[model samples]
Target: MSGTAQATTAATGTGGLARTWSSFHRAITTNLAILPTIASIVIFVAMIVFGEIAYGRIVQVSTLSNLLINNAHLIVLAVGLTFVILTGGIDLSVGSIVAISSLIGVKLAQAGWPPALAILAMVLIGSVFGLISGILIQRFDVQPFIATLATMFLGRGLASLLSTQPERLPEESGVLWFATKWKVIDGPKVNDLIVTPGLLLAIVVVLIALFVLHRTRTGRTVYAIGGSEGSARLMGLPVDRTKLYVYIVSGTLAGVAAVIYTARLGTAQNITGIGWELDAIAATVIGGTLLTGGFGYVLGSVIGALVLGLMTVLITRDGSIPPEMTTIITGGILLVFVLLQRAVTRARH
Candidate 1:
């Protein structure tokens, strides 16, 4: 048609697109549980772009593979923490559990025990610790923070007693074999896409968590307890049982994380999991799991793990920044999200 008619049509199309974008933004922002996750995705993308600008090869296939490989254990830990945080509780002992469990498994392997039995024992140790914490909190009315903190010290102390030095896995051990085996894919553009069993294990854990958190009746009860434990009890829900189960799950996953980490490194030590609890908590919070409880997504926590991994990659690429800055940056991000959560909570009321 005429030039003026064409310009008018283009303007109308632009206006329609703008309205659609606005509607989508409003829908996401109105849900406080979802807003932080969306923000995390944005921040992750920005970090990736920044990394590419600084390092020139940050977008390679290997870079992507490393992101998943390096952070798989952390992802598993964060998923577990999400469960506890969803129930309006926290587990400070996860990092210590990781250390102790890994030490136990590695020590057993070094002492010539069967790999399978050693692995089982390591996991059981974590479960037993978690069960103790759960009993203290649910049966004896101990605060979650205090109970888990006590376990944290106990775990670390036990790990140190086992070995002050690193314990390396035997070269011929099946555990080491599982850790090193690669699931290699041949891509058209990339010669080889390498994935580790640890990555696959992390994926499996996430899937199971997704089902438990979103599909099960117990999961709903966990949320209800987080929202209001008194209301949940009044409604005939098994509040104490569900709360105890959440801690058990957290502890079990910490054991799982320890296994993956030790396998990847082929060694274990008393200091193996120092500060990891904080990292898991940060990932959970960044992924949109409210510290106040009752809201979160498993996939969001995975994304949060990826975000942290990306931050590390970016900081490493920029060699001028001190390695210690990573914690500072993470702390800052956590603070901002915590404030955002507070604001959203206030607005909801």
Candidate 2:
């Protein structure tokens, strides 16, 4: 009887071990299902660890505050681009829109216009440009790349026609109010636990985008279109309307980013946002948003912007590394993420 009891116990232990192994395997498979997002998160955390080890001061409250303040506009731009990208469309004109809108708004403010009105004009300008692109693409059947490229040139040219030099905002301008910070803590190590209106605005934009993308029928239609436009159309989705809205969102957000950036800097120039659209696209892609469309998160894009901002901080803190290396590092990280995305896509197929 004792011998029989010992054999039963051993059999139970074996069964438990098999169950544990099976659970582990299932967990790994489930993680791999969203490999790009997981990879992005891992890389972001690794970068933070490396930064903390190298610059000890990187984890300070002031550093954290500055990270958000500096990248707030970029976060907004990336969020906007995520929508466009998720719909299998691209907007190359966002950078140009930033330049033109900022220039126009600043010029108007300098001309004694109400700050609020100027700001509205900036957004309107961007939306109009987007509308033009949408009409060209949807109505005339022009490719997105070509249509946005033409609009990009037009925006840049118009901005340059206004002035190549920087236009400074007036000292009493209300637009600069966006840069005001409210302190949340006081300490000698990092005194400013602060929040700016610009940062708050970015956060609000992100939250709105998250809600629209996940909680609304229009959002699902956007994803369906991205998955396959032909299929989406067959399902009676308003593909054309949704597509137009995406560009308009992208453009309007570019304008919003310009306002935030201009407020922070107190100056707007024709060259204010050169190549920024590329950074926006990079941030969206790095955040685990597939280039092929159909899957992404607005929050992930925000994290991606933070990652890029953190890289700059790390590079700056390391005095030995040339500042020029920042761009190279960014490109390398982007390429690595792209390769990882491709691998995951292949595995799924």
Model 2: residues >4 Å from true position, as ranges? 1-33
Weakest ten-residue segment in model 2 by summed lDDT: 28-37
Q: State the local distance difference test value for candidate 2.
A: 0.88
Please write out the lDDT profile of model 2 over residues 88-207, one tens digit for every residue: 888899999999999999989989999899989988888898888888888898998999999999999999999989899999998999899889888585556888999999999999
For candidate 1, list the clashing residue pairs, or say none. none
All models: lDDT? 0.89, 0.88
Each prediction's RMSD to truth = 2.7, 2.2
